[model samples]
Target: MNIGIIGGGAIGLLCASYLSQHHDITVLTRRKEQAEEIRTSGLKRTVKGETFRASVKARAGITGVFDLLIVTVKYHHLQEVLDGLSTLPRQRILFLQNGMAHLLDLENWDTSHSIYIGVVEHGAMKVSDHAVNHTGIGVIKWGAFHPEDTAAVRNALNETPAQFQMIYTDEWKKVLEEKLLVNVCINPLTALLHVKNGELIANPAYEYMMKCAFEEALSILGLAEKERLWSHVVSICKKTAANQSSMLQDIVKGRETERKAIVGYLLKKAQAQEITAPHLTFFNRSLEVLEKKQTKSFE
Candidate 1:
């Protein structure tokens, strides 16, 4: 299978390296230098203290058609990527963006293309343009966005390395919502306080704030099993104690965070539902301030 992976970020490099083992992989990057570097040095992935390299075709922009196009770009870049995709021939696309905001854009997507939504559970960091560090090994759960055949792509992806797992499910929306809930609980607080995930649960005050955010998000999402969901969020914090949340990383690097996609989406939903979400509103406003500060500092 010829698999085209858009976005040369951490997740993109990680997928290209692992999936290249079983399939022909082509990585579409935003910069010509990065694409040239990848083509010259190959895609490098380090996992569990061991490093591996896989040769993959690299290009600066979208080119040939692919059997499967897995988009690993951030939510903020989805619109730009979709605009580019519109010119290409129809193909199966699987979106691996973090927040649910991209779903709104997909509603008006070209119906001729087969669309799929997925949540990536793996933790990865880009070491360089052509290299990535696989911090945590986890499965990617995905489902067809609309009724369509997925057996070929599913079977092809599942045959890869054991550590890189692909799971197919019919309830992809629930998976996304649960992931969003976890993000809402941890990301904003961690980003604002500049703390690691463990500190959120380790500090009493921080833990209380996280709970407040969790309760608000749970209500806004209208998800049942409050206790169970809260426990899951806490467990994630414990599991990734030493690691920084993606939001925190964005803050530290002075890059734009996904506050709009995750928190902003919830805030809008809260408004539509007429549910008061003070904590969420506070987080959103605080993050906006921090983002502005970072931008000014960079300037």
Candidate 2:
């Protein structure tokens, strides 16, 4: 498969490095310097402590048609990607964003392309534009929002590497909802408290708040099995104990977080369902205020 990965962030570089082993990969970055650097130096990837390079092509914009175009950009920057490819045919664009909110935006797109949504479980951090740290290896669960997209996805996953495992399911809504549960619960609290993944579990007060957020979101989404998913969330925290949540990274790096897409999406749903999400509501507001203050200080 000829894969074109958009964005030059950690997830984008990590996916390109691993998938490039089997597929012909080209990375689409937004900057000329990054593209040139990759072209000159190849992509440097650090897994555990070992550093290696992946031979891949890098471009500043979309060029020719590809077998698969993997979008690994942040939720806030998604519109830039959509606008960049406004003239292209959307046959096999795989979005690997963090939140469920982008689905609503995708519905408004005036294209008949097959769209696939993926919930990434792996832990990755950007060491540089051309380097990524693969902190924790986890499964990538993906499914198509439309029925027309399924066959192509299966073909792409036919000989996928064991370490880069991909699971396909018909119940994509359930899959995304489960991920959204974790995002809404874990992201804001970690970002606000400026703590690592395990701190929420290690600290009693934070753990209680996480539980409240989880129960409220699960109830709102109408998922009957709460205990199982709660355990799953704890397992994730333990698994990625040393890793920083994506939101916290954004805050620390002075970039905008995806509170609107993650927590904001849930709040909108809660309103529609006439369900009160006070804990989520408070955290969302607090994060927004903090983000504003941070942005101002940086400016």
Candidate 3:
């Protein structure tokens, strides 16, 4: 299987590294330095028992067809990424990003773009130039986001290092709603407060804010009532209370956070429903302030 990974960040690099052992892996990046680093030293991974390296071809651009094109970029860059990939005929485009906001636009992107809405719960981070730390255990949820995925996707997924837990059903709306609940509750507050997943447990301040974001998002999920939505949010937060979310990690790096993708997406959905969620708006606003502060510091 020729697997081409877009976005040389944690997910892109890690997926390419693991899949390379079983398949031909190609990593696409904009940075020449990362390309040189990967070509010289291969991809380095640090996990529980062992740390090893694998040779994955790193490239600065795309020029050929690939069997699997993993769309691993952050949600905010989906448009630009899709535009670049427009020439790559028919391929399996698995979206491993977070949040529900971007889903609305997916149907419009290329009606034939076999979309697989993948929610990766894996905790991975770049420890160095070509090294990544796999911090936690999580599986990839496949066939839930888009039903267009064929048997080939299943075959390719089974071939990869990551286990694919297939939700074989036409009712993927429920799955996306569950994912949206997690993103709204965890991503924003964690980034805003500079806290890890466990911190949301210690601080009632974040918990309260998370509760608000959840209520707003749940309502948007079209689950019927606002209170029912809030209940789902509360239960899930307590479940994954230890890991550091990707959005929070982005904030710590002083880089652009995925607030627009997470919170901003929810707000847009709520607006379409003609509903006002003050809490979602509040978190979105709070993130704006924090983003502005971080941007100024960088400037």
Q: Residues 3-26, candidate 3: write the lDDT tens digits.
A: 888878888777777778788988
Tens-place lDDT digits, model 2, residues 135-155: 888877888777763776577
Poorest 10 consecutive residues of model 1 by lDDT? 290-299
Q: What global local distance difference test value does model 1 have? A: 0.92
Error of 2 at 102 (Å): 0.7
Give the per-residue Cα lDDT of candidate 3 at 275: 91
Clashes of each: 0, 0, 0
Q: Which stretches of candidate 1 lie over 4 Å from their true place?
A: 294-299
| Residue 296 accuracy (lDDT) in model 1 | 45
Residue-level lDDT tens digits of model 1 in 30-101? 999999999999988999899999999999987679999999999899899998998888899999999799
Better by lDDT, candidate 2 or 1 = 1
Q: Top model by lDDT, which number?
A: 1
Positional deviation of 33 in candidate 3, in angstroms? 2.0
Question: Could you give me the TM-score of model 1 versus the true structure?
Answer: 0.97
User: Where is model 2 poorest over a 10-residue stretch in terms of lDDT?
Assistant: 290-299
> What TM-score against the true fold does each predicted structure earn?
0.97, 0.94, 0.87
**lDDT for every model?**
0.92, 0.86, 0.74
